[model samples]
Target: MIPFRFLHAADLHLDSRFAGLSQLPQAIRSYLRESTFAALGRLVGVAIEEKVDFVVISGDVYDVSDASLQGQLRFYEALKELGAHGIHVYLIHGNHDPLDGPRLQMELPEHVTVFGAGEPGQAVACRRSDSREVAVISGISYPTAKVTENTALLFNRKPGSTLFHIALLHGNVDGDLQHETYSPCSRKDLIGRGFDYWALGHIHKRSILHENPVIVYPGNIQGRSVKETGPKGCYVVEVNEEGYAQLRFRELDSVRWQVREIPIEGLADEAEWTRAVEQAVEDIREELPQLMSVVRFRLTGRGNVHRILSEKGAAADLLTELQRRETVRAERSEYAGLVWTEGFSVETGLSIDRERLLQEDSFLGEMLRLSRHSGQSAEGLDDLLSAALKPLMENRELRRLLAGAGEEEKLGWLTSAAELGITLLSGVEDEGGAAGPMFSNGAAAARHEREAEE
Candidate 1:
């Protein structure tokens, strides 16, 4: 069998703006602005370095509003680089870049072939070393932004001319609740086609629906928001003599996004808390030492630091100090990589000695016991606990917060009643203690019980 390799990528979303951010340092902002283009350049670098036979981009090459002249020129330049290396390029437009969408009118390089929107098309790629057909790639683009048809069903089976076949698609297969159901289809439809591999796009998370025939989603090359966290890149695929394919994920993202929850338990003072946060940033930098990172941190767990952190504007102050340190680190560092906190949130409670509180033998102790008992066995405490929490849940402000919260999230908030109780009783003037008045009505004991049920 002739050895052949290809790079599979999707959802470039070039020139797309990063959401949920503002007032960032100029250096970080500059990096974020060029991250998508840099990721594409890295993909082209991979194609040249691996000397792959071809590259397949599933869809969404650019944002709907960003088909500017510069965007088109940058995309063309990348393709020209690949064509110069004798690597073939195959692509299909997705919902964001439909056939009729606004775009810069330009011609791609001779080696680049884009499938049609109205119908599926085939492109046979031949190995440069052997001059023989190595793979048959079939694909179709979206004609409009909303295509509810089962587009995968339109894909024909592998032709008799090539042993290795790949289906490049941009649709929601088996539906993901987080995304729209465009060109939706089931896994059965793809498996039935007997294609060697399915290159998928649109859902921004990498997934492998099957291994027997190698179906894959390479995800987006760059993450543009907090929701899109961790490493984002593409897959390099190689076929063996027996027709078995091996896939390996490559890191092409110039900037990475991460959300970390750090427990503040056992931390006694603000200094300790800051040290812990610094350590987390160091750990993240070590993990992705080559790429710059934008991180959001949530301080959790119960401790004395909770009181300090719960003060008004405490989180914002911490973020300011963190950003200052980030600037200093960047200036002092000799390396190219840098890391900074995008935002900080405090979700901690007051440290409460639950065992000691339980042994009080007073009304509060009895309430705590009842809360624990209700959780263990819903036998008798469900109604009692619900009644106790009713006033809090009915509060105009608290109700608003819990209005969209699911049962699990409600349970989590309810279970933190002990810490809230301790803070309120101490009159710490803390944010978490603000909920203390509602719990003072003896209804707070239901927190533990609610947790057990959850």
Candidate 2:
């Protein structure tokens, strides 16, 4: 006979908006929005497949207590499906979904039990067939968004009880700085507390805090940003007759986020750069074969590729080409398994002696020095730029034409002016820096607009 089984999941964070990405195509945006819901559906499927007795969701069921109606409706569908399979769900509210916060208060399925705040809530698990006792589950929810007290100490497990015990909690353990310190507690506070398993939440990265007693964090089911990278899913645990547990992590994210920094030190030209980017996509596809991936790419180091990117309109053209690789299936608007570039950045610098240029006693050198200072200290730069543009803004007719370039725009122009001059001057020195073009009306070049979006 199977000893005992259950699924441990937390930090669902449904309807959580993605960060660091803007102006995504409609189809891609839909994929990102639906990813959390898709993971919940998969979680339900896993419970039915594994034939687990129950599902324990520690906390943060919604991104907010007053979550969107769409998020609640979708979540309802998944739980309804699991209930149909005879699986019971035990849940608690986290900092994001506090008990006192606004909620829809919709009636949940009969098999779903949510623990309340203040005093820890208690429930017992039993076999549906014969009413045989399985385990005792105790948990507490957040009374409000800010829970400073150590709620973990308030649990009651009935000492010397014959049945196994499981503690469902959502809090910061040992004041983990990566997460907000709520319901604070220590490993000492949790251990030796008669819990056979500790189902925990609030920290979005999966961590096995301890074994034997089996304390763990399943992490979030979906990766909402580059910071939450790699495989994210719930843990399927099997407890033997003696109460020892084994864990298996499953990936359910519909879309994955990643950050890749490629060195462009020796890449020769635009063709090589394109090839490198393509390879990166292929590599990520290989790394995560089950889900679609969105990458934030940062091209680094100095190379000929940097010079081409410095040319006007070339970077945008490359981005357009990269986006062209994405394909939406004709039948559905959901994300197909195509690799999407969330954002692209070029940190590669010019291949000239910047230090010597700044130190030189020439007109270009002086300009470089002044521009450098203007870029370094944003405080006084705005005043100088605004003064210079005052003539244009003061003229009644010209103000109507040029007032759009505000203080921020002027600041950007001053910051990039030195690099633009260097690119122009270098172009006149030779054909692709070949040492003999000398004012030969060289090929037109334009500076790249931005270094990074974030």
Candidate 3:
């Protein structure tokens, strides 16, 4: 038998947040802020329950640049518990918790081993009484925040014949667009070193790059935002006597954040919209324990509802109302609690008068053409447009004007301009011409109406 069973975990972005949790209700805000520590405790609990030979935290134990002494002490206490059980704990500093800093003043337990920031080195862990000898455990810690050079060069040495070689690292493997390319390396760099398994971290999403050498990122122990969705947890690796390894993901997160998009194509009334929103929440609730998850509901699809839902006050109010509901509040809110928001847009049940509008030869049409072209090069045009159009879309007077405009008056102005945008975007003519009442079209019309109203 392999005689060694271990849990591999990384990227515990402890005490982190998703931009604006403070603005939510106190109950939810408090939960969101405290969930990180809760997840960390869960990790230690799993380690004890499994009775593994050792536990390896690849990197990023906490998120704070200057983590509190209390937080560090809490973590030390957890490790100490494992130490008491005669289970050794191994760790390395990731990008978030680089070696250089205002260090937390705490003495680690005897059974704990933290990799240093110097040249690549190995830590030998063994059980003499059982005649069990695990080969060289090699690892390197992040010395600074931005490590650009290849750090794999440090761990080029192979292990002796009598031991199982395991290497731990905290850096981007290759071109991971989601993360900065710190200490970049490749599968070849790791496998070439003749290591048995490469315990890696940095990316927050769990993935297995290579199985032969057992390269893995256990992801974050808990999710922190809508971006980090689905089942958040760690991995358990069991290495057999012949060096063959089997990996299984173990769920450890207390509160998971999920993003779900609900279509509104045929929702005819307020009841239907409410039901749809409820359904989205229910789906998430069904998939996860209500009391342990927060969901971000994104309203998608084409229809008049898009206009109503996209309005800043209406949208914000809807989210607030959803947050206040008992079913949502009690179950599906974030540890901080739940707050819904609109997501990506798809065309709704609205049409434009492309032919008649394109016939116009006016300054507005030329301006539209300019907007279309300039929008291409504009880096943050979407944000700028959204900000500029808020007042117009919300104004009752502006909506009435938009809803009642004639072909010659309204269609001619907007169609020509829309074509310019189409040309810039697709290098083609505006196939969907002068759309119906701006409010009925979708977010673009509502946005434009808001701008006009302003």
Question: How do the predictions measure up, each by TM-score?
Answer: 0.81, 0.74, 0.74
Q: Is candidate 1 or candidate 2 better by TM-score?
A: 1
lDDT of 1 by residue, 1-454 (tens): 5678999999999987776555666766666778899999999999888888899999999978776666678899999999888898999999989989998777777899999976689988888667688888999999888888898988997656656889999999877645678989988889998798999999888889899788899999998876688889999998988888899899889788788988988888888888888899889888888888878786777777766765545566877887887777665642245777777655677666768778887766776776676555443444544676688885885665544454454455456664556555544454543632222211111332232122
| Tens-place lDDT digits, model 3, residues 1-454 | 3456788889876665544343565666666666677777877787778767788888888755647665677787778777777778788988888887556766787788889887766777664236376656788888877778888778855533656778889988866645677989987888888777899999888999998888888898877655677777878777778878889888877677666667777887556877887777666656664436656555554455644554433545566566667436545543333333322222232323444444457654555554545455434344434455567878885665544444344343444345434334332322245232222234532453333222
Better of 1 and 3 by TM-score: 1
Better of 1 and 3 by lDDT: 1
Cα lDDT for residue 351, candidate 3: 24
Assess each prediction's global lDDT (C-alpha) against the native: 0.78, 0.76, 0.66
lDDT of 2 by residue, 246-343 (tens): 99998888888777888777787788888888899888878766678878777766556665665544556766677765744412542556687765
Q: RMSD (Cα, Å) of candidate 1? A: 7.3
| Candidate 1 clash pair list | 375-449
> Looking at model 3, which ten-residue stretch has the lowest summed lDDT?
342-351
Model 2 stretches with alpha carbons more than 4 Å out: 128-130, 286-290, 309-317, 327-334, 349-454
